[model samples]
Target: MKTSFVSNLAIQSAMRLTIQQTQAELLKRSQEQTTGIHYDLGLTLGATTSRSLNLQRELDRMSAMKSTNAVVTQRLSASQGALETMQKAAEKVRDTLVTYKGNDGVDAMKILKTEVNGALQIFTSAANTSFNGEFLFSGINTDVKPLAEYNSVPPSAAKAAFDTALTNYMSANSLTDMSQFTPAQMQDFISNTLEPMFTGPGWDANWSDASSQNMTSRISASEVIESSTNANTKSFRMFALASVISSELMDKNVNSQVRNTISNAAFGYVEQAIAGLNGERSSLGISESRVKKATTSLEAQQKLLNTHILDINGIDQIETATRVNTLKTQLDTSYALTSRLQQMSLLNYL
Candidate 1:
């Protein structure tokens, strides 16, 4: 038999390497046991790793969309509340006009004027409402206020333009007092001048900074909806015109005939405003429903993708735990053997 000489140093080095490898395996199996997933996905899944990566990427995208949809739902809810506020104010004015129509009594006229002014303030304030630091009714111009306050100090441009137009109309007609204002004259001025002021470029220049186009949001991969309304719509214009006419002329010294005409016109405009605003509310409600449905669909897809990813990368927890325990025992035995080797020195023998 051939005898080979092996140094204690070489045996200790081999034991040290074995201990290190055993500890590394123990750590890996422990992690897999705790997490119930493979410690190294690329190694275990091999060629299927690409499919797992793709599924995980799609799942992340759906998660991001769900977060975005939450913000969109909040914005839409806030917009709906603002529209309700405007609608309530308009309804108050409508009720006042209907209750006190054709009555030129001092108390009734004062009440009518107060309600009209209050409605205008409420309408403008609602239209200029902001959410998340952006104007809800400014459409694409989210940073800009939609409607200027009509009763501001020194008067807003809209008020100034309206005053100027009235002054010019009075001068041209040579009317000394509003009581001398005839129904024919008032109707002509309203149709030819006042209506255009509220509905034309004049409104953009003086009253509203809102865009005609509304804000739209993507609710799903293939679906988009308008998430906001704008103050530049015809409904908003009609509400402003009705409020202006009632505020400026309702308590004037005009005869009952002209006052009745003015009341009738305002009543008609208010009715239209109410109907149009309701339509806008309905449209937003539809968008809210679609957002909810899209969220549901995304959640279902996310659950399915998550299951697929787990199937690709998941480990058998019971088997992993058994392997981990076995590695721990081996590592402990190796540690003991290494300590024994370290102590087996020639000095100890001496």
Candidate 2:
């Protein structure tokens, strides 16, 4: 019943299959040892494959978020620095005006005007600060400059409005002395003309390069934060109005009465601006802290995800190497045995 001999073709085929299987095992072991990761995830985590895959996807998404957050942190840091510099310039201007309020000396006034102009220029440059080619103070209009030049050859809309009001006041009263105008008239001009010029449609016409909608970025799964500032903010407008008043008062053609009115207004505006600037600083500081905190938390999350992923897919190098070595030895021994068997003739069995 068992007299059938094994054919040469069958023996060859079995040997080939065995060799192929050994080679495949060797390759897998080598790969696992080199990479410290299993080649076949399904084989490594058969029952938990779906869970592991979801975790991997989460890890990938978190990695992308971390990368984006780094850029956001840089921009926020830069913005904070620029705003600090801007606030300092405004403070200096305010202090200087307060210190020399009643001094009408040519030399003293000249020095004050020079300082005001310098501070204004510094503030203007800060307002136009950029990071990675995007304007920081432009709100959603990242590509547009947030402010026109402080002494633009063609006056800004706000400045033109002020000029027109001044001309009308002089023409209507037939008065050379702006002092002739009562306190009520001066108040009316400021309320109806200058203040309104920095808000609503006037704000859009004068300085805003930004939309009302701010730029926002997701800092976490459930959290988003504003990533932009704008020239139209009340704090920025207050500083701008103060600067314009100081610059105009420096004109020698303007009388002492006009200069006094402008100086008093400028002083009040500067004081108010300091308070507004403090609020702006407070808000920005809070946002910066949040960004830093989010970054730290995200980094911790990513580290945990990496550890979890490794737990699921990582192979032990020592064990994998040992398995490879055993396979190689087995394959070599099989080849040697096969060769010996081939050499043995049927006559040897007699």
Candidate 3:
């Protein structure tokens, strides 16, 4: 064939382009083999872009849930510890009071008084407990301390009223002996006077915890959990009443009959308090277990989502290696051809 100048130049340009294209292909495949993910994800995941993006978004949400759940779990754990400690203190006082019931010894009452005071302090301190600057027992009022300090100077108005009523009632009745007081009279004093102080307007006035509302956290797409407990529950009320009555019983000015009646009341209240505490602990335990299970499930889902994303965009190592070798051979062949064509000329052909 008699090749024209323009035709020969066009052939050489086409050969050079072919060699460059093959070299680029070799580089791409080599990178794919080394990285496993495609060098050009947009091209590799062309049709599946939407699916992969959705999966990634879901995974991100799951990760975020895990992080928040960790914080919730920590707070719940701290609350649980405080509850258990308070429970133990209440139980110890209950056992001692029961042991010394009806003894009426001045020395014994003194010891029991000390124990009751200690239990009260423990319950109050636990109620005011905080985790990471948030009050654990304040329900949604995380920023507020849940309980008043047990012995505030000058006394709370409610405490002052309580102190005066018990003293005046004892003096007005002219009953110096606790045996003169009936359980019904003590019940009247408690229901009409003291219980209201712990559970009704006085409690609301002094404490910062919400009435019954629990804090909730959403740990997954389908799961929401009560992440906090409040201080105004029946358990706390029972504990408060028991602690207060026991403290009252310790007053030597109160007749033995009054002390005995108060001790009996304290016994009943402490027993009920223990039962209530157990129930609260069980409920919180179940909540914790559910949160943990949800966390584990979310983690597993996140792993699966990552796998699916890799499936959409990841390269097969074996296939990438084979393609790299093949592209290298093609580029080598193209280079050899281009070099030979470069060396060739009309003079050589002639």
Candidate 4:
């Protein structure tokens, strides 16, 4: 009987230790959830959170790209509006020269010349347009103004330089009709315009990537009109019409025709700029669409990953509570059994 009691006592002690160890493990897991990886709980919550952070960062980058695109779009929209106004003026100039072909009037010619000079200034301003401190039409030369100013030079000198430049542009293309345009056509225009100034050459690297912010920025400064898209906000056909009109006025001894012709040519450059702007708009649209799609898809993926991470690491409080209560009951039973064994000595058992 004494041997049996000793043996039972040994078993009771071992069983209590086992119960305590099990409770300790439960407590450790709980702590891990609360304290992250460094805590005694040793839960996967910290790892899950880390993954979530990485996804969030990528989302943030995509969001920033979208914001950048929005700004560029707005700027382009404003530029297009300006181009439209300039085109109307160019058409009017053409009509005037056509009107003055036989009508001899000094006062009328003076008025037309004034309007033409005003148009010239407007178009030059457009070419020199800037956004946030960088020139929009200067290609890669953001700081350098694309249109030259000749306030210090005499009117004839200015006209001579301007006409020479235009003639150079026309001759450089050897392109009689501004109908079809490709990447090569555009590059040829740029080369023709910049080549005279630089013996070396135009920088072909200005638009190396589709995502080039600078490329989009230089949209409205083409040297000549290829199509209506390239047509000055006014239109190349319209500019040619104006030139014909100006020549008619010159034939009729209208003094304003010469100045008006020069002004019309400059503004015509503004008209062709529309094509470049449209190209940029198209590019921006594609970029924006891609960014939005990518962002949305990435967000969805991130959300799913987050859900997975939660499942891996998150605890069900209700379930845990139930478990804890059950463990407590078992522990209490063990303690009670231990007490019974300790108290029930051989003498007491009798």
Candidate 5:
């Protein structure tokens, strides 16, 4: 038999190393037990770690899209509310015009002008509405205000342009007095000059800073939708025309025939505005529905991906807990043995 001498230092060093390793394993198993997931994914999953990483990345992407969809839904809802407000304002103006069409009374004209001005204010305010620090009616120009106030101090460019157009039309036709403002002359001016102003580049130059292109948002990975409308729409232009005609020309010192013509034109424009607004609202409703469906799809995909990720990286919590408890017992025994070894000195015998 060969007898080998082993020093206490070597035995203590070995025990210390064993304790360190057991402590590390215990910590890992404890964490796995607590989290119900593998503590070290790369180590446990090995070559398949890339699969877990990809699934987690996709899950994160879906979460981001869901957050964006929440914001889109909010913006669309706010825009719909604003449109409804504008529609109501336009409807009020239309109803008032219809109610008191032929009445050239001072009070009726005053009421008509007041209502028209009110509607213009409401429409302008609604068109300039902002959500999440972006203008709802600015189209692609989200940071810019869409519509200038027509009744602003010193008058807006739109108001100034209207005055200039009226002045030029009066000057060109050599109309001396308000009585000379015939229905034929008014119709010609409205058709040839005013209509073109609202429909052409003049509107962009003077009235609206909004873009013709609307704001679009991605509701899903493959789906996109226009999330905003602009004040440059024909509906808004018609509303403005109806308001301008009713406010500027309604209370003028003209005959009933000219007044009726102005009333009829304004009413027609208001009707068009209402219908166009309804169409806009309907379009937005469709987008809202699509967003909802996309959200549902994303949730289902997220759930499926989570299941896949769990299958790849999930730990058996019951087994992990048992291992953790076993490690704790081993670590305690190691600690006790280490303490005993520390106390093992030849001085006691001496």
Candidate 6:
């Protein structure tokens, strides 16, 4: 067997190239190695990783939705609390007025009158309940002060009754699905709630500033209230508080007769408000439960996704080390063979 200079050089070059290529490939594989190039290993891990990425995106959306819902829920609960407090106050006034049966009924009326004024103040304050700078009872009028400083001109009766009742209703019944109040709910509030109050006894020309600030804050309701079946309804909910008014405590404080009127109206109205609040609270409870369930569901999906990612992108240290060792052996063997081949010449073989 004879080898010339060109052939010898060629043999050495070929061996060096083979070793370098193999080493490079081994290193690349090592960096991103996983199982299943071997038939024994199934694609579960890879599939899991792929699934994980998709699940992660969904979870992100869920997390964001849940956060917003939390804000709404807190405001709602606070509004409900305020309504409950007003209801208690109204009940007290009712008790006091009813007790003043005969001649002392005038006294009863007097006490009732004072009580009614106090209760009205409390109720109005509740109407202005706020959360995160937004009024909970302002019917989305984020900037509108819920209760204008006790006004005398517009005869506070209409505004007071309607505003309290409507806000209480919105606070309780406001669907966590904000979508229920869009394009229609705002208009409904204006026409049904605001217009009625404005046109009624509370229509004072001076409170126009108060009237101008309704339905002020909203993005797409559907953006928050999305659902698989359909979006939330846009109908305005009427609470009992709006329907009943104690004109006794109109623009200014009143006497015993007015107290009796307010006492009679406050109880029925507050009872109605309570019922509405409970209904809305029940709905929110359901949503909270669903959100919790979704969180668990997403967490489950995350596990599968992680497994898939491991299969696709994560390295299998055991298998990688094994394969790399094998390639290293082959490379060493080729190097040795090339060295021998390069050193050989015709004279040496002879």
Model 5 shows how many backbone clashes?
Answer: 0
Q: Is candidate 2 or candidate 5 better by TM-score?
A: 5
Q: What is the TM-score of each candidate against the true structure?
A: 0.94, 0.84, 0.78, 0.44, 0.95, 0.46
Clash count for each candidate, listed in order shown: 0, 0, 5, 10, 0, 7
Cα-based lDDT at residue 80, candidate 2? 80
Against the true structure, whose lDDT is highest?
5
Instruction: Report the lDDT of model 4 for residue 11.
Output: 72
Compared with the true structure, what per-residue lDDT tens digits does model 6 show for residues 143-260? 5664543434765554466557556656866634323444344445445655455444343332222332232211122333211110011101122232234323221233434333
In order, the Cα lDDT scores of the candidates are 0.90, 0.78, 0.79, 0.46, 0.92, 0.49
lDDT: worst 10-residue window of model 5:
27-36
Off by over 4 Å in 6: 1-56, 101-107, 149-267, 303-307, 317-350
Q: Give the residue spans of candidate 5 off by over 4 A.
A: 1-6, 347-350
Candidate 1 TM-score over all chains jointly: 0.94
Residue 89 miss distance in model 1 (angstroms): 0.9
Ranking by TM-score: 5, 1, 2, 3, 6, 4
Between candidates 4 and 6, the one scoring higher on TM-score is 6
Could you give the candidate ranking by lDDT, starting with the highest? 5, 1, 3, 2, 6, 4
Q: Better model by TM-score, 2 or 6?
A: 2
Alpha-carbon deviation at 297 in model 3, angstroms: 2.2
lDDT for 264 in candidate 3 is 76
The local distance difference test score of model 5 is 0.92
TM-score of 5: 0.95
Please report, as a residue range, the 10-residue window in candidate 1 with the lowest summed lDDT.
186-195
What overall lDDT, based on C-alpha atoms, would model 1 receive against the true structure?
0.90
